[model samples]
Target: MPEHEAGGSLATPAHEVRDFLRRRREQIAQRWADEPLFRTVFTASRDEAVEAGKAVVDALARVADAQQVEDPDAAGFSAVREQLARMGAARSRAGLSNTQVSSELAALWPPAENLLVAESDQASPEELRAWSTTLSVLLGTLRLVAMQTALSETQSLIDRQRLQLLEVATPVIKLWDGIVAVPLIGTLDSARSQVVMETLLNAVVDQHARFAILDITGVPTVDSLVAQHLMKTVAAARLMGAECVVSGIRPAIAQTMVHLGLDLGTVKTRASLADALGHCLHELGTNIVNAAPDGAGRR
Candidate 1:
């Protein structure tokens, strides 16, 4: 087999990259520790960042040894994926876009290249260029992997936040001793509907309420899907030993329901939240009377 020689040593670009990474792991890590990607993330101490940088160097060495420097899915990357993800996420929290994070990663290249060049002082220009290219490709792949992981983590965070917002928006208010109400104000998708159902049912059991009201005046439109969700929520409340009332059915919404042939016959309906509360009060044997013009109580 033929051999590529650099400084009297037989070494291909891959072999040189592997050897360089192994021989100078400490130096590489120390230098990288000061980079924003590592420094900002491992804030407790400089040593922590240095250690994290060492892990990345080790992973790159493994990739070079395996001759898969260009492969993002190379097994070498598995060890440092979580670490890279954390770094990426931290940069994101610092208001760095993916492009900016990538640029920061690119900044790590010069220090490594300089070290490699110093060690290759006796090597020919062609050999040094080849080694530099190999290292650059490996580091570029690392950037790709980090960005991928960061995007995934960001999406997961967004999903969690959205669910939390839905829960917050669909708050179940205890309107009275034996009545609870959920005032919904937005588009009713399946996810929000599920949240509404779960929250309303929980409130029913917690409050021991006899009546539950779902006010949808703020909901602009109701499709068949929305109707189905509402029916399911009402049925669930009924099973939990509470009667559910649908309120705030505007004339336009009522017309829409009629046109769609959607039935709320099994569910009680009211024109407004005030009317629903009035019905609940009537069922609970409560009464309201007019007060005098003065600040006296009503009889």
Candidate 2:
């Protein structure tokens, strides 16, 4: 009941579109449920897709009522922003490109268009054209909102994956009773260094480790930043009642540390992992005596 008269003044485009959406909400939802965007996401049941479509239709109607169809930040979009973002992410995971997703969304208009046309029988051609144009603009804004939210979701996923990779790369191994080690093997940045610190600390507490080893035998280089991170990690371990050993300082890296005036006197240093383990064993009162011939070395 949008007060449409063939010979009288008609309602504004916003009013007309809002009324159209309210009247045809069910039809639009039924049609959109079959589109790729909703169909693939709600495969558990067609009813779920229909419900999601109704939510989006309700949001659009609110936007039209507010005369903010072109505004992506309209209050109406807040309710469905997360839903749209998830849809975008799902489509991306399904290997559909942005253009393909957009095309799928475009398919939703025809059903709504048919409904609009049917309702506009009494509308003059001019009024009908205005209503159609308004609806298109509203749809265009919906596309913008969906794409923006999708990009944000993608970035969030990348950040999470990167953190997971860092955790995998900086694994803490329990080498012996009361002894744990993290064998460093890559370029250490602030982020990865933070991960290393957290992972090492967790291992020390979980393993009740007395000696924590940071073996950098596989590291290619060590600069001031890397040294600083090492020192911080060592300090954190000491605070947790575990003494830290810095091992795998090759000859070249040792010379570089000396030339750069880096002083690591506070940290226990060893040339290799085996040497570090030997030191830990010695501290723990374990001994390995030289073996004589004829297997006489058994204690």
Candidate 3:
């Protein structure tokens, strides 16, 4: 062969080696592109892809070093073999073999490059699905909290109304044929007094009573407002064809009533419930027997 032809022949083999390396790299990349694991890694976060790519590079480097060493007994070859063994042990611990790692590495090469180029903030379907599930849980928790708050507020309002209603709706006892006794227990405000007046008037008409006993024995004190309310109640009882008997007048209450200048001309006065009952019997032409109480009907 001619000298130039010999050189050209030698260069042709080098060119072929370069071409072979290029073809092998391209083939490995394409094969990885078709793999499901490659696609998953590519679509994963950049940090994940980079980590997987590094594992693949370490594996390839170990295999390359083993192949490059010549004699197995030589120092370099022994060192390479030890490195390969250590890499193998690591791969085993990681739940993969050398062959499996190589295949995965080849498959993931393209995705690794893509991951490097892709934006970090771009979210994948898996990430979005996870986020949506988290958001749904949060919204459900918020709704539960809101419902609990509403229920608590409603219960509080109902409790307050119940207490107010109890103050106004407490039952009275009829001590005589014509006289009924109502014991005031708590603060007798104007609003509460109006309710009490209406209740007493209704009871008097229903029972056809000639007299009612307004007893304030349990009451601590009286205000001008309460005295005015009592006077109005007496007037209302008179309009309903019944008389009122004021009883259990404490010293403070008497002083307040006198100070307020409330006239009880239409109503009778008594010192106690028994006195009111006796007076009512005198007016009604009746007497108390060994009988059960009025409110103690067949319940």
Q: Could you report the Cα RMSD, in angstroms, for every candidate shown?
A: 4.8, 5.8, 27.8
Ordered from best to worst TM-score, the candidate numbers read 1, 2, 3
Superposition TM-score, candidate 1 onto the true structure = 0.76
Per-residue lDDT of 1-299 in model 3, one digit per residue for the tens? 11222111233322322232233444434444455443453454544444443343333333223332112232322322333343334444567644564454343434423432242245554443332332232223222332333345557779999677766555667776666777777777777787788888888977777888888787777776776788888889988888888888877777777887766666678877778778888888886565566556644
Question: TM-scores of the models, in the given order?
Answer: 0.76, 0.69, 0.43
User: TM-score: which is higher, 1 or 3?
Assistant: 1
Candidate 3: misplaced stretches above 4 Å? 1-164, 167-169, 287-299
lDDT of 3 at 38: 38
| Candidate 2, run of 10 with poorest lDDT | 1-10
Model 3, position 147: C-alpha lDDT score = 35
Model 3 lDDT at residue 204:
90
Q: Residue 213: error of model 2 in Å?
A: 1.5
Better of 2 and 3 by lDDT: 2
lDDT of 1: 0.90
